[model samples]
Target chain A: MTALDTARPGISPTAAASEVEAQGRGGGGGPSRRKVGRVLTWLALTALAVLFIYPFVWLLSASFKPRGEVFDNRLLPKTFTFENYIAVWQEAPMALWLFNTLLVTVLATVAVTISSSMVAWGFAYFRFRGRKYLFGVVLATMMLPQAVTMIPVFLIWESVGMTGTLTPLWAGNLFGSAFYIFLLRQFFLGLPRELFDAAKIDGASNWQIFTRIALPLCKPALVVTAIFEFQAAWTDLMRPLIYLRDSDTFTVPRGLKSLVDQFGFGGEWHWEILITASVISTIPMIILFFVGQRYFVQGIATTGTKG
Target chain B: MAVAADTSVTDSPPGRPPRRSSARSRETRAALLFISPWLIGFAVFTAYPVIYTGYLSLTDYDVINDPSFVGMENFRALLEDPKVALALQNTFIFAVLSVPTQLIVSFFLAVLLNRAGRASGFFRTAFFLPKMTPPVAIGILLLLLFNGQNGLINEALGWFGIDGPDWTTDPVWVKPGLVMMSLWTIGASVVILLAALRNVPQELYDAARVDGAGWWRQTTHVTIPMISGALFFILIVDTIAAFQSFTEAYTAFFGSGNTTYSNDAALFYAIYLFQQAFEFLHMGYASAMAWILFAIVLVVTLIQVRVTKRFVYYEGEQR
Candidate 1:
């Protein structure tokens, strides 16, 4: 198995058997049942994957199709045009939405990653009174639903005169995120304590040790934290809806909601324009996922099993 | 013996290292410095809000007026408010019906992917794309697909000579439609379950097969028990999330002003709370509703943990 394969505990039975079966086929033969099983597995997997992906495929096709042809059963547009994209741009403030979304996403990701890493490092390395209790409190925060805190938080923002701005949308991350802190703390604890002791002998302070040793060694975990934070901020809708009112400050989700309001749901169905806007909104996230699939997978795996 | 004693004394020279209390105090200072952000945030954002919400639940206040203590009037009002009961009923029904289906369907998908061999990564990503899709986009897509006459789902049903129900408009079908849409994002649970499945030992399955266990028997006796911890984790987390369902329902029904199709059928507990706080400016009542949700979730979680104690098998823990 590869090093990454050992990141988790168990091996895939099918993967292990396939290798043996391949060797057996090269030498003399394996059972016909095994070959049939492999074929059947492929067939079943292909069918399900298609079913899962069909909605996105349909969405992509409809984004290009003209309004008159949006309802046709054809998978591909009979007459493809850039008209829908142009219409979405001229009719809506797409650029402002992109700007606001990017601003919050980038700021939130950076702020959350740094603050969470620092807090996680403290929990990972320091020995202090009530540390265990403090960490338990952090874990407990994960179960606290946003609905529970929505009103008071809104009031807090309003009291500070930040309610109508995007500042409230992302300013919360400057404090820290519980899940990211937990994930990063697991990564920190895995580091050899000897490194920190050696740094201390070299007259490095705790801050220096964290900046010089812990942060550098835990690059993968840090990247995972940044990616998760960015994706969350990008996809978040409810917070923006609560905080933002003006269209100019609207994030992609709120902007997309407005598009739906203006076109899709108002008596006349403008599926072409609505679908185009949806496609535009999704493109960035899809690209990000494809580019960072490894980190994304690692983050999900660690979040599930790690304490 | 004299030399060894001298070396031991020299190991920690007098006046070289700081005092125990001094060193500990310094470390405490540093640790607090490192975690100061979280400490402040936990107090201001999380801790204060929860406690203040509890207090707000016992009072009557609007944004314009100072909150006055009302002594559980809002909670008592909940008994008389038909909308509050409907919202609670809708939330309960959504959680009860959706949680089990979510667990089964996601577990089945995870099982399929686990046996998928080298193509597992691709399939995992494909299935997960829907989960990654923004809730707003998914909401819009739901509206488009579930449109009564010209939606894609209805057209597909037409190909088979079946007329699909009007999912958005009909109150009877609304909850089911929301559940269906929610099911599209089961990738998170699938990923978690897949990881859990990977942690199960291969030897157990082999030993079961040797004991004449069929696929179904092996799955039931070996697979399920091994991953029970992860199963429980996702079940609790998903149920809590299901109770707070908002964005999807809001986008489909409330976002667009189509009163003909979208109605109170889509008025979930969280949505109603949003209405009370923002639309009607009933902050105190909304805070009361929020506390009730919190208590229900906490109690439900406790009950599940207690009930699952008999069934959930950890690897090394004793019965």
Candidate 2:
């Protein structure tokens, strides 16, 4: 039941080897067949890699191209120009949006990390009446669809006159998210009980043990939590769309959405600016992913394998 | 002698007989203190919103006026609404198409990466990069790549001597186009399934081979069962996500407030709910739609759990 509770919508993979296996079997048998199989596998993988990476490559290339050559489908831009980037800055509030996104993302990420780790520490370290029930509730929240919560949560902020303000975006994260708490709790539980006992014997209070011992020891998990939350907040559009009515208050994704509206769909047809803004918004997250690649993989791997 | 000495010495201090209970209570207090943030958040953000939404579903709410009690009126309207049916149909089609495709593609990619061994690291990073792209950006890319005429996708298809449909403009092709776009972010799934694949002991494959199992047999019997738990987790998660998919579709079709595109084709349940709650100010109707979505998801998830229980192979668990 608890495992089911933690089932937030995510991604996964499949297995079927009929044609490939047949191909492997048909080849000049034994070692030659094995060699053929390996080559085929490499080919398939490389082809898929290109399919996956091409859009970003195209987007990047298009961003540097002039408006006419943007969709020329060539890997290299025929006429490379940074004019789109230059004009994007002048046309839209890109810098202000970036700042707003950074502020909200930082606040949300930091708040979720600290708060979730603290809650996780409680779940991991303590044995109390109703503890299981409390943890169950935490897990259960993950199962609640955002659609169910969105309107009422918006109304709550609206009632408080926090709508159209950046406060609504990060304020809820101060309470900690269920998924992070669960992830951090798993990390916390892996810590040996003896460490806390030793700290207690050394006259360190529970709070002292939590701050000084648990947190530092769980740095990798903390980094994972921070990275995940940072990405989530940075890319989050729904909350911003709901709460942020003004252009100045919009986050990067929200700003990008507006740019898509303006350039791609209805407004003016300066698509190069939209493409430029899209690339600009994507780079930070791409850099973050590279920097925290190890932790990110480990964290996602644990989520799948553990529960 | 040590056991006798320990029993004689007592665990507590000589003058502190009640210390154990006090210490237990103190620890409980400390635990509560630590988890208070989650508790506060749960009450306000989760618990309250859920209950309030339920209440709002029963009323006529327009955000400007007070929510008046109009018991089940919104739910009744939801039953009569043609758009509700259309939205649900769109969402269902999307989930049906995207979830299994995602699972299969990600699994296949994971298998490829798993076999790649040392070279897997670079490929895994390459594959996972797209998952890092912002949803809004993905939406923009979707419009650009799938742009019916003179689009990169159509141009690529032209090279293969196949004509492409007007993906953004045509109603029939819109959902399919969205599914194609969804495939770009299967990186997380691939990484997850790869982890699961790596966890499958080599002994199982060796044993299968010894028993005369071929590559296909080994994959189906040994490799798949070993990773069924992870696969099941992904299935449930992806299904729920597919149902709730908002950002990319919203950004692509509805974000611009453009009436040119076939918006009905992309009118997903969550998107309609958004339109109702925010755009149309039909807060009560949206709340009702939300509850219906919740109920539908709950039933679907429960069905999945029941159905997969027999098939999912949790290691060391007794049959």
Candidate 1 lands at a TM-score of 0.92
Cα interface RMSD of each candidate? 5.6, 8.1
Candidate 1 residue pairs that clash: none
Candidate 1 residue-wise lDDT, B1-319, digit = tens:
2343344445555776535655666677778989999999999999999999888888887888999999989999987899988988998888888999999988888887776666789999988888778888888888778776788888888899999999878888888888988888888788888988888776566566556666677678988988888788888888989889888888878864665464677788999998888878888889999998888889999999999978888777632
How many clashing residue pairs, candidate 1?
A: 0
Per-residue lDDT of B4 in model 2: 33
Q: For residues A1-307, what per-residue lDDT tens digits would candidate 1 score against the true structure?
A: 1111111234454455654443332224454556665566668778878877888998899888998988785789999989999999998899999999999999999999999999999898999999999999999999887878888899899998998899998889999999999999999999999999999998887778999999999999999998888889998888888888899999999998887777766667687888898898888888888888888877887676542
lDDT of 2 by residue, B1-319 (tens): 2243344445545686555665666677778889999889888988899999999999998988999999989988898999999999999999999999999999988988886645788899989999999999998888899999888999999999999999988999999999999999988889899999877765565566556666678778988998999999999999989999999999888964586556899999999999999989999889999999999999999999999989999898632
The sequence of per-residue lDDT tens digits that candidate 2 reaches over residues A91-139 is 8999999999999999999999999999999999999999889888888
Model 1: how far residue B28 lies from native, Å: 1.5
Best by TM-score: 2
